[model samples]
Target: MKKNTYLLPILRTAYESLTKSEKRIADCISADVTTFIGMGIAEIADRTDSSEITVNRFCKKLGFAGLQALKLALASVPSEEVISEEGFAKEDSYQHIAEKIFQNIQNGLADTLSLLDYDAVEEAVEALLAARRIVVFGVGNSATICQDFETRFLRFGSIVEAYSDVHQQATVASLLSAEDVVVAISHSGATREVLDTTAIGKAAGATVISITSRMGSPLAKLSDIVLIGMGREVRYRSEATASRLVHMAIIDILYTGIALRRKDYAANIAKMRTVIRVRKQ
Candidate 1:
């Protein structure tokens, strides 16, 4: 796979989960990427006061093949293009706040794209397309996303449903068959209700696809395909709020991908438009 251009964003996104020694290495690189790129694995290990094996493991965690690949990828990044993750301050004017919000969303989307695995997305589209039924589950803020997914695909002539209530989700999951697909959306990927419903769906032999921020979360573990996105937190704003856009962006991707592959896409959309036109008249 081609390397992503946004190296620092990837590092920033993964920084919280790194081990102490791994963090030391990450700090050294993020602090001075230009100088760090010139150094070898042994040199990086020595600089970080860690071992070569630790360095290799750190590289793997960042999706690099090894130190050389990491260096090459980092070197490929244009020095002038840096991501600014700063949030708006309380004293900022309304205009400034709007600009900051736009920039944050822009950077967040790029960061998510950097972490995205296209192969996994393609797999998800295929699963959704072939499924006998598609059941979507989410709760709280995510429930809105589930509803959005349901509405988008429903227009494309797909047998899809979205459930926000835990009981309804469970009931839908219980009746799923091998040919069904379950899509679970959670920002933290630890939503208990979502997890339980997804588990039920999996138990009944349905394929599970999860869109979440954390790769190691239980929701990801339960999924047949995991699509991870990033959302940075700013003061006064929750990460979940930021991640909603990211999750919806992924949904857009899936919606477009599936729509493209469906033979009746144009016809289905045209029929829906015709029906809506009658109400407008």
Candidate 2:
């Protein structure tokens, strides 16, 4: 079995670089791993006799948002055990390959959920809900995700459009206004067509939101709000496979949030269902 590792290993690796006070915080967590997960930041700080800032800094050192994100990542360790046991291996049996693929997808979802910032998600939801027209820009695998996003929003009665071709994306983006919202989906955050369309959207004064893996990529740089997806890309998997799953998860979050906030969303869903049922009949 492969070793099950998560946030603890990251803390251990960064232990030497930490300040003496931060090391105390790390030591406290290392000593009582279970207790650390349930404890609040203030509680942990008090226990370690360190300021909350130090605790926050310690989490950032390990590439987390703060204490809450660190706890979320720590809470996912049990699932890592499942992933370890079902890890992909060369010459594996068909059953093993199936199990491994399923486990990897589960792990990716868990990681993406843990890494997501709820505030950013809420902001994205609000922007989508308030937009006069919603435009989604993507290409390749990311374009498929954009289509799903557009379809879901349209079901809720939003004026939404998705464009995969660069020319169409650019034309639509150029027509957007301040009241419009543009969601750009690119797993690598560097797709030229997506980037170009996003730039045009921004130049037109639309609120540009990006769903991507890189925080510092061009898409993110041009975006008004950046929603990050899982960055783990397996060598054996095709481009954007795992990332697309994460993107779809984010889309679901946005759709659910928006639906709940809309006044007649439930009625709209019921009406849509009835129409579909009639069409099938």
Candidate 3:
């Protein structure tokens, strides 16, 4: 749904009235607009740390028949980006498509910004900074995202395990310690393999960070850190386009944030590599 729509305005107003904890719920709603728009109030409360009373108050404050009415209102608008038979990534009209990409990119970034628990991000980064290994887990598209994550972390001199196979992921997750961290990516938050891997990671006393689309998903509940994508952008079916891109964009931002935080050390490491390059030459 576009920002200019009916539900968006009331939700924004109600959002301003939220307390710290209530704001958490609001953040999740903004992160995955479609999911929240369709979800039950109890689910929202469970994810956001709000009680039934507060949830009702929050809904009333938004001028709904409590929560279901709110959901129906949100559901009224088409959730996907109705592109004119052209996907956002096509290069045929480079400039026009570039602008659209910027829009989606900005929306994805907004989804991250609105929902990101900065403290959690910091905690996850701290773990990575101090860890002996930064293992990554996910299934399907998330595995591709994990591979990209492993690539980025390796650039910072961190050891990485990027596992696409469930058995392989479980095997490595089994070996992690409290000094290690697993960054798990799952769009649905219900991926059995990723859930299993993260469960193993948790049981092994390792920190877990979940990147997923739904805040109330099982993966989020299990994770120490949750990074959500509010990409109800693909309205119609169970397609994997917009939301996945949103997840990767968050990863990119996180990767950039980590790299910038360690920029000086990374630069020094690069400078040291120059001597080795020259010697080889």
Query: lDDT scores for all predictions?
Result: 0.87, 0.78, 0.71
After superposition, candidate 1 runs with Cα above 4 Å error: 1-5, 40-43, 46-50
Instruction: Record all residue pairs in model 3 with backbone atoms less than 3 Å apart, i.e. clashing.
Output: 31-230, 32-230, 80-235
lDDT tens readout by residue for model 3, 1-281: 22223454334423434578767866776678787876677788888888877878766655455777667766764666232223544344788856655565565555445555566667667777777888889887777888888876676766887899988888998988998888899877888888988999999999888888765578877998877664534333355455677777777777777777885666756876887699997
Q: After superposition, how far is residue 120 of candidate 2 from its true place, in Å?
A: 0.6
Best by lDDT: 1
TM-score ranking, high to low = 1, 2, 3
| Global CA lDDT computed for model 1 | 0.87
Candidate of highest TM-score: 1
lDDT of 3 at 248: 79
Taking the tens digit of each residue's C-alpha lDDT, what string does model 1 give over 117-175? 89999999999999999999999999999999999999777899999999999999999
Candidate 3: what lDDT?
0.71
Off by over 4 Å in 3: 1-105, 236-239, 268-281
Which regions of candidate 2 deviate over 4 angstroms?
1-90
